[model samples]
Target: MSDTESRLGMPSGAGAWDERSERWLAEGAAGTAGRAGEAASGAEVPRAVPRRGAVDPVKALMHRHRELCERAVDPLEIAAGLEAHGVTDRTAARFRHRDVFSLAEEMFARVPRDGDSQGFPSASPSASASASVGREWGWALWALLPGALCAAAVAGLRLTEGQTRLLVAAAGVLAVGLGLRLALARGPLSRHGAPSAARPATGVWIGWLLGYAALGDGLLRTAATGGPDTLPTGAPDGPWPLATAPLLALALSCAPAAWSARLLAGRARRRLTSSRGLEEFASAVRPLLLGSFALYLGALAALLALCAAVLDEPAGYAPTLALGALLLLARLLTAHGFTHAPAVVLTACASGEAIALAGVFAGRLPGCGFLSVPAEELLDAWGAGSVPALICAAGALTLLIHAGRTLTRASAHAHPTPSP
Candidate 1:
């Protein structure tokens, strides 16, 4: 018998049953035709009854989709496969089911839990489980590499001076970039099945946000102080007001982001498997989502505190923390396949920062004093960083609400592939 037949517990002579059913159907049709002709000819004939029991309606469907049902990891996969093949609730009713999900559940149950038939050799269950656990731990450690690289870079930046500082900074940036690439390649942040279109946009927005944090705030500070009419092309003559602390904090956050995402995805997958319906799944996964978010925030706060202490910067900056939270939430959403909302939120925050800068610059104009009042007052009260903090905090809150709704859905975690 073929692998499919063995896996599905079908007899080697199943084809004979198909032939017999076909013959019965053909004979039944012919009998009906004959009875119609006799009645039309005024010679009444008694109807013939079937000798065998009625064939199950779903049996044919199950045989036709045997491979799909057997290969599915869960009923959801079978349901998705069926829907992709144009099966709907109406189509499911023909097979005596209320919907495609119910039909898929029945099909999944009918298949025997034999060895893996997905063209791979099966291992002992305990061995496979142990290997999976090992890989998870390995990836978790790998995820910390980016943060370590960034921390090393921060230390190098603090130790160097003059032109040598520039070289060390350049090398540090390169090292951190490579570390980020390696860390995200196979860990929880790996981008296996993320939407292709949203990726470029996401990268653009992330760069904008980070770049603004590093240099844009200085420009706004310069403008607010009425120091220059033109934008700064090179380093300022005085002490570099670079807010590297926030940037470093964000970099160090990469590991926490990955861990939180893994925690949420792992727990959500378990919930998906155990829950009987959408409501149950949502209820079980919601707490996991909130807990993961809180865990990430706590980790980010610790990283921020560490960065601030090492760099001798203020640690109470709400904007820095808010930006970190916003970034983590955005990355989490994009990794899970909900990309549009994050992209949009990031864009809005970036625009708000840009507008704040523009308002500062415009306030220097002859008749646009009112345009800069808000920016100047905010700067005077809380410094230029407050602008980004407010903007990012709003964006983060928006994403938190959006995540609460989208991430709780079963469809959001449908594929559950790693993302970068």
Candidate 2:
């Protein structure tokens, strides 16, 4: 066996090392000898000499896939290409890597990024990601449409009365829904391929959360405080008791949510290209993730304040802000293909809200006042909005923790196969 093959533990055979690699290694050795002779002759060598007996196992693989690595935008793409060609985590071990991703990353790092040598203009990773994000900026603008529609509907609701108000509100909700669908259709939030089974369940839970916020919360509060056990139809002289602040805040938040998601995705792709290891990538991305989330929350808070001012409602309710944050985080996770956690968290939050309302009603039964006591105390201490706030805050916290772990992985951002 040749020295390089022996060091790499490859058995002597034609399959072990290709002729091209042998020639390349021979040329490299000759070049190294020439450099050493020049150094011996007192001519300065610009680069240090590699150790005499050292051999990089990945060098051959890197050389073999030079074109692939040079053209790749990120390590994930290289990993995907390697995977497509029958490379697995087990195969990666042959190159002294933990997995194909690690092997691909090493190869990507070794390859020169200069496109001039490859006879083509290559965009820098950051520039390419930014260009891609700029192309989709329309989604952010579209996101504003839903909020505008809802705000106009709220204005119409205030100006109308009785059946007319209800009609306006229903029409506003429909328009907002359709606008939201359009906004998410082509952005980072767009879902690819066959919808998962959990999608229907996610929609149902989302509907429940919104419905409860709009009406169930008020009814539950009224009943807990000893008001009549009845739904509030729109009073002719006043606006409907719908929680417009949360709805308005959430709707207005679509723009920031889309922007934040795009920002994070672009930054993450750039980080993937620059990060040297998985741990490095995670460390770098965690801060970007937190920053994007915080930016969204700040934007949501500003919108909530505006809504409260225009609607003449209290702006201090934690539930609305919590729900907005929860929804944004859930959407962000889902956008990145982490669907299960968001669905599970949303369901849990919805169930919690339902159970709280149910328990309050159950307490209304004779001798069952204990069930009502706890909920009533919470409402009395923090107001009725506290129920959804506490539940949604807990759910948001859970999703944030889950996202920190799952979204940091390289595989989460990779699209290895075409969606059917």
- Candidate with maximal TM-score: 1
Question: lDDT of candidate 2 vs native?
Answer: 0.72
C-alpha RMSD between model 2 and the true structure: 9.3
Shift in Å, residue 83, candidate 1? 9.4
Q: Candidate 2 on 275-328: residue-level lDDT in tens?
A: 655667778989999999999888888988988887887675578778877888
Q: Kindly provide the TM-score of model 2 when superposed on the true structure, using C-alpha atoms.
A: 0.72
Q: Clashes in model 2: which pairs?
A: none
For model 1 the TM-score comes to 0.74
Whole-model lDDT per candidate: 0.72, 0.72
lDDT tens digits by residue: candidate 1, 255-365 = 888888888988887776666555566688888988998898888889889878877876645877788889878877766656788989998998888888888777778
Measured on C-alpha atoms, candidate 1 has an lDDT of: 0.72
Please give the range of 10 consecutive residues that has the lowest summed lDDT in model 2: 2-11
